[model samples]
Target: MANTKKDILTILGISIKPGESKEVNFDVANLHTSTPVNVPVIIERSKKPGPTVLFTAGIHGDEVNGVEIVRQIIAKGINKPKCGTTICIPVINVFGFINLKREFPDGRDLNRVFPGSSNGSLASRVAHKLIHEIIPHVDYIMDFHTGGSGRFNAPQIRIVEGERELNDLAKVFGAPFVLYSKHLNKSFRNTCAKLGKVMLLFEGGKSFHIDDLITNSGVNGVKRVLNHLDMLSSKFKVSVPKKDCILIKKSKWKRAKYSGMFKASATISSKVLKGDILGNITDPYGKFNYFVKADNSGYIINVNEAPIVYQGDALFHISTKLED
Candidate 1:
């Protein structure tokens, strides 16, 4: 038998031995206000060898709950591990985070740019770097997110339905719901899936703020997965019993027919029957209003919290029919 210790290092060439942590800065962009923006990475390696799991957050900068969740997990410390590595990238979109916006500085969605080109736009370059430098090294990945700004969502896990291994991992993540979403064009999850790595997307709360309940649920979810993988020593006692989750195969956004002050009778996580009143669109004054209702029987997975809206703005995202 041999006792082998693991050596942790960054893409920048800094060394991090077992029981040690370090921040690795990735160059994003250099501007008048600041030099190359850094993507902070927290690495925790165990003396024993195991699979590496990357926990990422802030892919859509305004989504802050996942950032808090990752921060808390790192703060708790990995006292010991049965095997492997856990790398935490709490903020992937540095520019979006600082501007409090959802997309990159160039107004591109980071999530939509994957396996990107090095000679392309800033967002593309970042995506390329991540794919080349990070994705290949990890066995498992958990990309954390929340609803975009002005929308609220129930805590849930998003995965492809037939990916049994991923679905099982989603259960270990313990979100209230697990959405069965197909691969989208150029999305990160799709890219990772193509590479044979099981990636789970945990979504909850809303952008730019922390919801303690959602945050706690996310942190526990990570631990539960780690325990399942035998990376952590302690067994994770699920604090909250798993809630019934609707498996959403397809979702449609209800866009605003006319722009005006909006009022909603339904909230996030509300279940609505066909023709049920969801809300009303009205002029700033008390007169001239139109009702918004569900066209199908389903669960309200996402709702716009912002009162102001424009024509064609997405108002509600519904998951048609529920899954037992």
Candidate 2:
């Protein structure tokens, strides 16, 4: 017979026997004030043996939607594991999180420094620890994210490249849409793919703010994925046939033409044709106005929610398809 205890206690480098949940902390950085910051990880092991699934959020400190999603999932409770374990890391960037910023204090984007070296910059060291220690023990990984500050994104799963299995998994997660995205070098998803792991990126809402709709969608999506993996019992039935996801072979960012107050005529997820008027940038006196237009036909996946903008700042992101 196997042990059936649900909650166990342990720290990093120490392993508890099967059938328990343990909280572990990995040291990320030490502040000038002598306070050490750590990444908190929760490991939930099932009574029955199975595959280990890792759920990570807040890689960008400002992205709160993912953090909330992970929290809600853990709060709901996991019963008997159908197969193995579930590891949840709610926040990955402790430093950035503390400051409510997206990048590290050194101004480095942590997501772009993946699979890093131990003896590198602060961000690189943190990335290295995640890549080397946490990622290796997991089978499947889900990294949650949101649009950066002042931007809004529709709830979507970004499946890297054309991996059919990942696409299927994203569909199961039941986001409004799945974005078939090309993987970027040094991204967490790309690093995992290189290691032969299936990774799904969930992006939604705006950073540092809580949108209930996006949060609920994300919570339900994670649960759906767990059910699909047979890690959780399936009790709820999906109401709609899975939506056919749009394949974003490539994406383009529309930048502000000039510094001023801005207004957008459309929201994220809206479809537009080439030369369609999207918004306008106007000076304080309204004397100078610049119109922003879509350059091609595509769906808007990201839009600036803030009304103010500076010249050359990204205002919208559209994904387009090329003619054969």
Best by lDDT: 2
Candidate 1 lDDT, 26-136, residue by residue in tens: 676775477667787777677677778889998888998888898888777642355777778889887888888889888999889998889998889888888877777
TM-scores, each model vs. reference: 0.89, 0.88
**What is the Cα root-mean-square deviation between model 1 and the actual structure?**
3.1
Candidate 1 positional error at 11, Å: 3.9
Q: Tens-digit lDDT track for model 2 on 14-65?
A: 6855776677887867987988776778887867666778889988999988
Q: What is the lDDT for 96 in model 1?
A: 86
The lDDT per prediction is 0.80, 0.80
